[model samples]
Target: MELIEKHEEILERRAELLEQMESRREQLKIQRTKQVEKSEAARHRNITLLQDLQKIEDRLRGRQLPRPHLLALETRYWASVEQSVPAWEHFLLGKGPHPTDGPGQPPRRTKQTPSTAKGSGLPPRPKPRTAR
Candidate 1:
């Protein structure tokens, strides 16, 4: 039950933080004309992640929520629980849908083979055999 309570708390906190963060972002946009939106975006993004963390933390707390009911969830995602908790944990607990497992890295780009186009810098491949 402590897990549920913590989840509730985290969900609540996440909502509040997201709301404030977004509002601040909007304010920054309206207030600052063109100096730098990057900083504001970065700030809001950080807060947004923190909110997510709260949500996740709540999930770790789970329905049991004993002394540290979250331990299970922590073990499940030991390295990741601290990430913005709310949104993350919410998803973790949800039934509708969830993100897929980790994606492997994209295939590394190899050197492009030389094409027939003029002035191409790539080395040419050996000629292919022609049909008799």
Candidate 2:
């Protein structure tokens, strides 16, 4: 009879140990799930930060570089000026017609000095009166 009671007690102890082990396993599973969720949240935040940084870098690079169309326009303007420099110089030196003058327009005349205008036969201007 004593041997039977001892065997039954051993079985009860085994059952209690199994129950404790199962509870510990369930707690470990909950902790593992929480860790996985936290890791995933951190990964998402890191990806978002990287994307934002890329956008900022792209904007900065865009500001640094000139647009192709504007660069082309500027190059063409300078080339046109270079090509017309000789004509502009001739016109400024009075050796060529004005660049913008139309056909049949009279040539620009030089301003005449008072001594030169005397021979033009115009009446002389009266001198200004002095304050008495």
Candidate 3:
């Protein structure tokens, strides 16, 4: 009788241990499922953020002009300005109209005073003395 009771107790303890192991396995599975769901949600957010960043980069690129084209335009504009500046200086100095001006335009002329005009080399005559 004692042997039979001891055997039954041992069997019962084995069954309880198996049940506890199964419960622990189910809890681990549930925790793993939740972790996987969280990871998937984070992945989705990361993908969206990367897409947004790409779109912003594209827009910035679209708004910017190419460097070579901009540089060409700047060079042309400065060349035009440089060409006009010398011509304007010549005109202001009263040298003449710009060479680029057409033939129909009259030459600019400034009036000359006697001091500025070319003169023959001659001595000035003395004024006659007044009668006493």
Candidate 4:
């Protein structure tokens, strides 16, 4: 009888220990899941920050120098303007041959006296009546 009671007690203790171990395992699993979720969140944040940094770097590089195509366009525009400046000056100042005139002909001058200025489409204003 004594031996049977001792054996039964031992079996019960073993069962209790097993139950505690199972509960501990469940707790450990929950903790591990939480840790994994935190790590994944941190990883996503890091990736986003890296992408933002890359965008900023790209913008900085763009600001440092204009694109080659835009630079070329600007250079071409200035060259065109410089080339035409002499012709424009000659035409405006009437100091040399005009671009539209024959090679050796001088620029033509137009008279611009106010009395002869009737090019405006609007009818001339009536002269203000004197305050009699």
Taking all chains together, the TM-score of candidate 2 against the true structure is 0.48
Model 4 Cα lDDT, one tens digit per residue, 62-128:
7857789999999999999999998889666746665677757765655655654566444675889
lDDT of 3 by residue, 23-108 (tens): 99999999999999999999999999999999999999889666998999999999999888977887767676755677887765
For model 4, the local distance difference test gives 0.85
For each candidate, give its TM-score against the true structure. Answer: 0.25, 0.48, 0.49, 0.49
Top model number, lDDT: 2
Ranking by lDDT: 2, 4, 3, 1
Residue 91 shift from truth in candidate 1, angstroms: 99
Model 3 bad stretches (over 4 Å):
66-132
Model 1 C-alpha lDDT per residue in residues 25-118, reported as the tens digit of each score? 9998886765467687888999999999999998987766445657766666855655556545644554323343345744333334344333
- In candidate 4, position 30 carries an lDDT of 100
Off by over 4 Å in 2: 65-132
lDDT by residue (6-45, candidate 2, tens digit) is: 9999999999999999999999999999999999999999
Task: Report the alpha-carbon TM-score of model 3 versus the true structure.
Answer: 0.49
lDDT of 3 at 9: 100
* TM-score, cand. 1: 0.25
Question: Which pairs clash in the backbone of model 3?
Answer: none
